[model samples]
Target chain A: MTPYDIILTVLTTLLALYLISFALYIVRVLKGPTIPDRVLALDSLGYDLAAFMLILSIYLNSPMMAVCALSLALWIYALDIYVAKYLEAKEVGG
Target chain B: MSEMLPVIMAFVAALISIVATWLAVQERDMLIATLFSALQSTCYALIYYLLMAPDIVLVYLPVSVGILPLITIILIKKTERYEE
Candidate 1:
């Protein structure tokens, strides 16, 4: 087995692990007993997905796809702030 | 295995997306449902990336993951948290 094959195997294994956790996160999102629980799961899923995108870019052999990971990382935080304020019964925004 | 890694990843992501959509609609709480919608959007964005459509991911991330959830949560606050 060459070194390149070893690298590909490791990447595929990691990607499989991420996908498995992704499914587990979905289960948590589904069976969550509270709104906050569900929101928290969703938050983790977003960030996890961004990481998946980065890995995918590497697998795809393209640096351009990394930009999606960057923007996706930036955006999901808005959901957290909005939900927290709404739960606290405070003004969400102007 | 190396040759088909992207295709396999995309398939798994697609399945997750379907499950997320089902969970989102099945929720009794609007807030939780909205959160699930965000998850669904996230899966879609990943699918976009897997399909090599970075441009779509750019628009989808901000609009679907960011703005859509924010607006929906605000509307939920104004309406009702739990559905009857």
Candidate 2:
């Protein structure tokens, strides 16, 4: 097989790995005893998903999808900040 | 076999999204439910990406994951944390 096929195989394997971890993250989100725990799990989940998307874009030969991955990472970080503010001050500033 | 990888990945993402939606709907804590909903949206975005719809993914990502959760969280803060 060519290098392209090898890269495709690796990317596919990584996608599966990410999905399995996503299942674990969802479990943590659903079953965690405290709100912070769920938020942390969600944060990691989003970050890892962004990485997965980047790899997917490379595999698919679509550079535009990389932009989505960047936006996803930023939005997930914003989510963390929002949760932290709400948890600390009991308010999310308008 | 390799050509169908995207289809398989999309199916798995869709299944995960279903689980997330159910969890979000049934959870007692509004905040946790919102997080689950965000997870659901993330999965949907992945599904769109796998299906080669970059435009839909772009619009869906901001609206569902960012704005919708922010709105729901604000409502949760205004009203209550627990469902009851």
lDDT of 2: 0.84
**For each model in turn, which proportion of the native inter-chain contacts is also found?**
0.97, 0.50
In order, the interface RMSDs are 1.1, 1.2
Off by over 4 Å in 2: A91-94
Model 2, docking class: medium
Worst 10 residues of 2 chain A by lDDT: A85-94
Q: Name model 1 segments beyond 4 Å from true.
A: A90-94
Tens-place lDDT digits, model 2, residues A1-94: 9998888888778777877888898789778888899889989988988898898888788887788888888888878887887887655453
True lDDT of residue B71, candidate 1: 82
Candidate 2 C-alpha lDDT tens digits along B17-48: 88888887888888888888988888899898
lDDT of 1 by residue, B1-84 (tens): 777877877787788778878877887877777877887788788778878899988998899988888788778767767889
lDDT of 1 at A71: 93
